[model samples]
Target: MGLKIYNTLKREKEDFIPQNPPYVGMYVCGPTVYGNSHLGHARSYTSFDVIYRYLKYCGYKVRYVQNITDVGHLVGDADEGEDKISRQAALEKQEPVEIAYKYELSYFEDMRKLNILPPDISCRATGHIIEIISHVQALIEKGYAYVTDKGNVYFEVKKFASYGKLSGRNLDDTKSGERIDIATDKKAPEDFALWKSADGGHLMKWPSPWGDGYPGWHIECSVMSRKYIGDTLDIHGGGMDNIFPHHECEIAQSEALTEKPFVRYFIHNNMLTVNGSKMGKSLGNFIVLKDLFKKMNPMVLRFYILQSHYRSVLDFSDESMTAAGVGFERLRNSIFALKDVKIAENDDLTAYPELDALKKEFLDAMNDDFNTPIAISVLYEILKHSNNELNKADRDTAKLEAVKRMIFTFTEDILGFNWNMADNTDSGEENNREDKLIEFLIEIRKQYRTEKNFAMSDKIRDTLKDIGITLKDAPQGTTYTIS
Candidate 1:
């Protein structure tokens, strides 16, 4: 079956076929790079990372381009507050570009922690000034944009026949709904900016035909995507909140100039809400990911996001994270168990009805739009069977091995979530203070047991079990895990 994708532009699920065979072009709107990445940031990018990984794994060469909006992403999002990186730079008392470099490195590091491979090309808006200027110039020459006396280039939204097609709000309806704060001289209220003549106080202005100004927030993707991919891209993705003037203006400016579809399929992941409200800094509900890592495994955070469909709004909380942590451990343990156990010859298949059924169901769920939550539940079924078999001395070889591969491939490779078991890179990988200390104490407990200090051994074991990690005594040695 062909890959069925939910296109936000079409407002329906449709068959996904690329413009070219054996190669696909994908562009995802990356972080603004003004602040530290949070849990919600991870969910959106990691979600697309799985899609990028799976497409390449399916034998297609994919060029994944994600842009860093260093200069023009306004703090209030649409176009109100200060430049995000610039604002952060003020708080840190550093140059805006310095802030960009710091967080760009930090953002990729966090993504690497989750095992998300870096994109093929990482473009920055500030670096692509020429491309954006040329794009805005083309729009001007084609009669799709107008420049103000103050050197601001705004796209004429009323001139585009299909201005609101992507977001499903007709042009008339959008105009009525918005109390547009259009610069008094603009031709129309909904005419969003393509380039702005930066004021003297602006820290990150560039010289353009319009003046010494920066490109607007929406124009970055419009220019960068065309510079890297083309005017018409195969897949353009971002958070659902970006469907408005951000993406809509991009469509108007790009399509009005190029006379082609700006992006073929529009994909959006829903927002991350907290306490029944959307998570945002404005709402004062934002939690920094680096801060959260102090308390939880970052992999568990990724797993928690994957447990729901990408389109559904995921409400994050301690309770949900704790549940996801337990579930992820079960998956990790099943993978470990599979590596050690050898499969025996199964003479017949009918005996393992529940096991066989699970294998079929897991693939079926994955085949349908990569419904990972359903696929994860299918994994639990196999986890249940694997744990049952592990409890007993006898193991069915074929059934055991098959489920192991099924769980590993789907969960790790396809879903893009895995627990890191080996030594961390060039440093102690597991960063939680509590976890590292507990590991240290467990090592000492192992040594105590080795030295025949039964009294001290029991005390450490009892203490750790009460916290979370259970010390298991086996014939080979002692192993521990967080419950």
Candidate 2:
């Protein structure tokens, strides 16, 4: 089956077609880099990473561009607050540039831990000020934007006939939904800022055509996406949270200036919540990846995120994470166990009907809108059959080798797991130390199981799995393998 993706703009799954065949230009809204990267950041990036990976796997030479919002990202959606990085700088008593660079490094570090591929061009908003000014000027010339007496520039929502086309909210609906006070300088309450006039003491101001000001949040994406990719992008992706105002504004200003569609397929990943509630620092449920990495492997978190479809809401909890850890360990252990199997030196899958069916199922799942959960289920099924085959006294080395190749292709290539980190068999001393550590953990788990404290026992098992140790509970006793 051909690949299909759910285009948010179309509001349906559409056939994957690039404007330029065999070449895809993809853009994803990146972090504002005002703080540490959190679980929300992980979910969004990982979702797009799979898209980027799968497109390449399907023979598309993809140029993925992700922007770092280092400036002009106001804290308020109404575009009426201090810049996010500037606010963070004030809180930390540092320069705004310092805050942006520190957190930009943090964001990339966390993304690397999750095995997310870096974008082809990582553009920062500060670096693209010249381009942003040029784009805003074009919008003004086209009568889609207006410069106010206050030196602020706003996109004239009413002037753009299809302002709400992407968001499905008309001007009336947008005006009624304003929780934050609308900026009085705007021609209409719904009109958004293209550039905001910076105050005299503002730390991140640039000399634009409209006096000394900075580019607004929406303009940066529209500007940078066009500068790197083109007026039209094959795939534009972000969290669903970006759909309404941020993405909607991007469509308005971009189409207004270029007179072309902003994106072919607008893909949005669903938001992640913690224990059924929205994750937030105010609620004390915010999960920063660097802090979470202290407790578990980042790959386990990636596996957990992939367990649910990207369009489905992912509820985060310690319990759910532990469950995913166990499943991840089982999957990795099964795949890693075949590392020593000798191949038949013949790459023929026709004889292995079961492996062939499993391969088709895996590809079918991935092709069906990158359905990772279903794809992961196929991995489990492959491992189950492989385990049954291994139990036999005479195993087919060729069949086992074929299974290994299929599993590796899916898990390592498409799913983006670091098998080397999971199955690191270093030298003698390190291996000896890891072996003893596994034995120690196993013994503790056994005691907890004896005491009927299944929760504690399960915790021990899951914790060990998070660190690349897989324990097997057999009828005789519990034995462990270092993944």
Candidate 3:
């Protein structure tokens, strides 16, 4: 079956097809760079990273553009609030640009620690003021937006027929949900500002048609994506929380100007929750990514997210991370075990049913809209068969090599889990052997201590500790994690 995705715009699972055959353009709304990124931010980016990686794995030449909102994002997402970056700047006693730089670097560092590749181009709103003004002017010319008496610009949502199609919201009923105070300046209750006039203390003002002010948060994505990726794109993605005023306003302003479909596929990731409550900073329940890195490597956090589908809600908890740690260890350890086994080489091999079956299943799973959970399950299934084979103590070289290549290609290359324990240099082999030997020594030491042979146990641990191998015995078992 061909790949299919549940598009938020259509509200159905549609067949996947790029506007252009091999060249695909994807736009993901990036962090605002006002503060430290949290787990919800990680989920949105990592989910899109999966989509980006899998599309390239399928031989699509993809240009992924994720924008950085350095200005005009509000303190509260009510569409009428103080600029978030400016607020952060004031709190930190720094220029807005300084705050943007610090958080933007932190964001990329966290993403790298989590193995998320940076986008092909990261366009920031502050950098693209000219382009944003141009787009906003186009919207004004098209009559979809107009300049307010206070030098602010507002998009006329009622002028666009398909304003709420992406979010499936009724215009009349949107006052309570995702709505700000419909100020007297706006044409209607659903209307959102395309540009906010600069007050006297505003730090990040630009030269727009409407005097000196910053571009609206919604206009940033609309203008930057269009300038970088043309009038339309293959995919656009963000959190489900942005389905209304943010993305909806973007739609109205962009389509009104270009008269082309703004995006082919709209992808929205469900929120990451803590104890069944949304994990949002505004809600006072959020875990910063940097703090998470202090506890566990960010890759563990990424792995935890992948255990559940992107479209499904993932609850944040210690138990979930602990479980994900086990899954990651098992998955990587199995790859390591595969490399350690001895297998024969084969040239003319048309008779390996087990090996062929495993490869086919993995490819099939990954091809189906990048169903990574199923692909990971296939990894376990392959490992199960290989483990049974290993138990026989006679390695099938062809099968071993095939499975090794398959896992490395999908897990290491595509998923970015290099599984470095599967290396093949002499030093690497020696290191692996020493690791196993040290593990055996630790186990034997535990047994000796159990029998009250304290002297021998002490001697063994001392020798290992001197050689850079330390042991920690936990309630679960006596094992070693690299320092």
Best by TM-score: 2
Clashes of each: 2, 0, 1
- What TM-score does each of the candidates earn? 0.83, 0.87, 0.84
lDDT of 2 by residue, 1-483 (tens): 999999888789999999998989999999999999999999999999988998888999999999999988877766787778888999999999999999999899899978899999999999989988999998898888899999999999898888777778888999896647678788888888999998646788889888999988999999999999999999999999899899999999899888899999999999999999999999999999877876677788889999999999999999999899889889878987888878666646558887889889999999999999999999999988778778899887777877888888899889998887565322234545667778887888889898999999999888888988789999988898665
Off by over 4 Å in 1: 79-81, 177-180, 343-360, 421-483
Can you write out model 1's per-residue Cα lDDT over 1-483, one digit (the tens) per residue? Answer: 557788988888888788885878899999989889997888898789878877776677889999998888875664444777787898999999999999999899788877788999999998888988998898899888899898888888878998888888876776684743446667877777788778747899988877799888988898888888887889998998888867888888888888999888888998888877878788898988777766666677778888988889999887887788788777776667777766566534356777777867876665566677997888887788778877788667666766676677777777776645321221223456556787788789889988999899899999888987798878876777777
Clashing pairs in 3: 344-397
The order of the candidates by lDDT, greatest first, is 2, 1, 3
lDDT per residue for candidate 3 within 1-483, as digits (tens), equals 566777889988788899987999999999999888889888888888888888888788999999999988887775577788888889999999999999999899778766788999998888888888888888788888889888889888788998788877778767665554556778777778788888646788877768988777898898989988889988999999888768887888888888999999998998889978977667877899876665565556766787778888999888888888888777766777787655455533446687678777777766665667777888898887667767676656666666777677888656665344223213334545677898788879989999999999999877877877777778877776554
Q: Which pairs clash in model 2? A: none
Whole-model lDDT per candidate: 0.80, 0.88, 0.80
lDDT of 3: 0.80
- Of 1 and 2, which scores higher on lDDT? 2
The window of 10 residues in a row where model 3 has the poorest summed lDDT is 420-429
Q: Looking at candidate 3, what is the lDDT of residue 37?
A: 82
